[model samples]
Target: MSRIPPIKITPIKLIIPAMFALTLFPVFYKIEAQDLKLPQCQDEEIVNTVVDFFISESVWSAYGESKIKEMINSSIHTANLTLKNSCVPMRRQSGKLYQVDMTIQAFDPDLASYRNQLLRVTEPTIIKEITQKPNHYYALVVDDLPDDILGKTDVYLDPQFLILSDQAEKYTLEHELGHLANAWHDDTSWNSSLSKYLEEYTPDAHKNELHAYARGYNCAGRRTIMSQSSVYYLQLPIYSSPDIFFGDETCGDHEHADNARQLREYARRLKDKMKNNV
Candidate 1:
């Protein structure tokens, strides 16, 4: 098994490589264009956001409401910081920032009163009933998720609703939010191009491809939060970006992926749509 590099940081020039390779991996990233009833992205210079999280009775019982709120808030803070570091134009040129405040409340009044258990749910109606706006997000924190799932997002929704398992890792919210921002996984092509690359180049590269995916390495082999989750975890709150480099490794345009750029585009598109609506 090839040794996984230890987490390290060495400053390098910020230069985001072009994503021409994205066209080759449309299966992993493209969504068909169609009319969507979900909330649209706003055309705003600044994003002042509030995310509401509903705590299930069972989860609240296991970990008090305060603890749950703290964890979620911390995750959001990390996400904001990652955006600040990875996407410079949001703060420097545009004077825009991604700041999200949070509210934690009881999941359901009836469920809270009787300590009723809420099952794992993916039904659109249930989420729609609770999701009030397309500009903001609503997350339902439940007691459990499948062994393989830490959290899941309703991608079809405009402002997505996230179903987070109580046992999810600290940065799981960040990873899910990346999905909401249209950021594809850094390791999304493991079965396709990545496997082929490994076969041609480093056939003995990694013993576990899933772990490799989860590492979400940029060209320099630094971990990015948006990669698929594996036993190897996100050591730093970083996203792959064309504008920032966390280390010394250099990569060609074809080898790069830029989640940070996608986030910037998401905000821009939302701002444009909001302007048209106005």
Candidate 2:
């Protein structure tokens, strides 16, 4: 070949950029799942579970290779650690299973991953269309969710915050899932009649700042997976029997069962809810 200029590295590098100007090959770098960080949760093993009862291979596949890898990377980078002033747990009576209709569209590659996850997770449950009859077994998801929620429950995301913000994403995902899983606020119904001191100190409007500590402490002890101290793995796992099935296992052990501090925190929430009229 006529003097093939010694492999021109600089020119070669420019060639791709130059080519992109004329050609349309949407190129993107591959993101590795290892790059992300997840904190060592209270119960590490339980937190890592992706059991058949929960998200299985089929479900994982739907997350799309790139997106799944990205979510993992983000987690790795941030190291899913606990945030102070963060915790949410609600209580709802046990009932028959219900289906949730979570129809969401992806506006970006990352957003798409979360939407896909929602579609996949609810697969085992019946997806019924909107009709006149009331549906105890299904829910209607109307919008796209944020990133941390990628493998978790999907919910309407607020525009004020970035979907990828670890704190926001995790909190939002857990809160919505609380509703999806039918968990109610530990507030339950407060006994308005209870001494102003009791209501004021509890997680109630009647409660004043003095009891705020007490309110939160009691809420911590209810022992539901939905407790404020839970990590993704500790949240509700899929119950295999059927959509409507609820048994002994349906109830989840406290994610922080070993952590006496968190357990006491939960107790406050529980007490407030059990308060008559509370």
Candidate 3:
């Protein structure tokens, strides 16, 4: 992602052996080309199989199960965070489930509302399998991935998260769930608007990116969940450590977290509106 100047600090050089240990041989962080897809699975039995894939992929390891539940909860169960003017009522397509497609789709207002309820009103729903498609935004688990690469979304899958196993769990799901959050990415002209931040930093340098993200958006460096404060405190790019943060030199401080307060405010507004609607 770093296309601008070289990093000022000594770059974190990884020895070849260390890189291999982290599975960096096939770096998934390569600049992505076009979106890609998996074999489509829309049939009921096929979808069930996909669900099984998710359970198998997620349950064995503590990290897998915990991450999956957290993702599902935050994605649909949490309160809304969009502006009031944009809020809408949740509708239920009872017994209807959108099959996983390889393609990405903008959030349906009704679906967004219903998903909120699914997260808040109803118990968390778990799919043993998933139906996949191209040109769609979806998530499912598979045996094909390595443990470090346990989680995958198209935004997180075909490209970035598949190889960057260390951060894959959150980034993969956050990238996909960001879509559900009314967050924007990909071809909505974010490249020109946001790419500069990624461009200005060093490869894997994370500080300034966190400061620049507005609501309803997600990306590599500083994003709402995956890119930001993870359960493990990936330090990522914005904050120096779990407890310490750079004061005002947000854009420069690799550990700065300028917008967190504003972000919380926005999230509260959205949550209240959604609750009222429900």
Candidate 4:
């Protein structure tokens, strides 16, 4: 009988490169709900809403899964308060609930680079995706966001994704969600005009440097969640009402009331669209 060559067994060391490639190249990794250990809430309706959690390998390596989950849970609780109190009721009247589908990804190379990619390359795709569907939103949580912006929502270009910094405060997520729901900046009309004029007139390279001055001079001084000023007033008590202008009655402004009306109208429009799709 002819000698048969022993079959070669691949060394484990040789296989590692392929494994590493597989791990590095995948677009995203799904995180199971059990892994999150999500904080329980009394309201089953809010709890029932699906949340799809995702984290980049880089983020997981840096923050660890536990820390990431903790941060996300905290944000979710804040968001739930806003949604349950404010958004859901309006949505329910239309025979539909406000459903949120959020995807959080970590930036590679650097957070700033990712921000540039979002603004330049991916924004169009994101806008198309969100407009084609209803009740879907995306958020990117990163170690660093633009120095001037703690959180921002571009409703026209990328309504799905809000860029949030890691150091974002308790109400920041809720504030960005307000934008996703069609709420404009607390002082959008006046502040935008003034800011634009300053940008045109000022020769300084740093345009946002004068933003605070512009806001102070022209803003209506609202205390709503959408206000740029609200971040400074975190001492105010939280309320369990559907109004975006719920806290600090003394600081209320007509803009807050207008925003509430806008929110309701936005919800009604979403409901009508959902009905039409069906």
Q: List where candidate 4 sits over 4 angstroms from the true fold.
A: 1-56, 85-132, 188-223, 235-251, 254-257
In terms of lDDT, the poorest run of 10 residues in model 4 is 15-24
For each candidate in turn, the TM-score is 0.56, 0.22, 0.28, 0.51
Between candidates 3 and 4, the lDDT winner: 4
lDDT of 1 at 140: 58
TM-score, prediction 4: 0.51
Local accuracy of candidate 4 as per-residue lDDT tens digits, 174-275: 566555554544344756654664556434542332332111111223233455543343321121122333222332334333444444444555666666
71-152: candidate 3 lDDT, tens digit per residue:
4443232222111111222210111122111111224322233222222322233321112211122233333344444333
- Report the poorest 10 consecutive residues by lDDT, candidate 1: 16-25
RMSD of 4: 15.5
| Model 1 C-alpha lDDT per residue in residues 1-278, reported as the tens digit of each score | 44322222121221100010110110122222221111222343664344546565567667864576567756676666555655512321111111111122334332222111222222334335434433456555665444555666534323445666666665666667666664556555545754564455332532232122222444433345665534433244556644344444421122346565566666666556546654
* Model 2, TM vs. native: 0.22
